[model samples]
Target: MTTYHVQIKVMPLKDLLDPQGKAVLGGLHNLGLNGISDVRIGKHITLQIEAESELSAKTKAEEACKKLLANPVMEFYEIEMVQG
Candidate 1:
């Protein structure tokens, strides 16, 4: 088995309201950064997995995101994998 490094990013759905993100955007505006209109806050997770191949490691990472790392109803996730 090979160890793989994975980065999972979880973000609020486009149509969903993100209070934290909104707060940040407001804060940015207050700081005189009006050029930036929107800000979306999200989570970045890094993890290691052991699998037989790159594909399997990626598949496991995807499964982890869909099942536990992200909320399917309100959030979406993107995964990036690398060799460790």
Candidate 2:
């Protein structure tokens, strides 16, 4: 098995309500950061995975995201894999 590094980004669906993101944006605006807009808060997950091939590593990461890391109903995830 080869060691791989995985990056998972999980975020709220565009149509769903993101109170945390909105709160952050409001705070930023209050702080006088006017140029920032459409601010969305999300999770950035990094992990090490062992698999037989690059494809397998990606599959494992994506599966983890679907099954445990991300909420399918209200959120979406993107995965990036790289060999360490």
After the best TM-score superposition of candidate 1, give how far the Cα of residue 18 lies from its true spot, in angstroms.
Answer: 1.3
Query: What tens digits encode model 1's per-residue C-alpha lDDT throughout 1-84?
Result: 889999889999999999999999999988898788668998999999999999999999989998899999999999998656
Q: Per-candidate TM vs. native?
A: 0.91, 0.93
lDDT of 2 by residue, 1-84 (tens): 889999889999999889998899999999998988787889999999988999998988888998899999999999988657
Where does the lowest 10-residue lDDT sum fall in candidate 1? 30-39
Cα misplacement distance, residue 8 of candidate 2 (Å) = 0.4
What RMSD does model 1 have? 1.1
Candidate 1 backbone clash number: 0
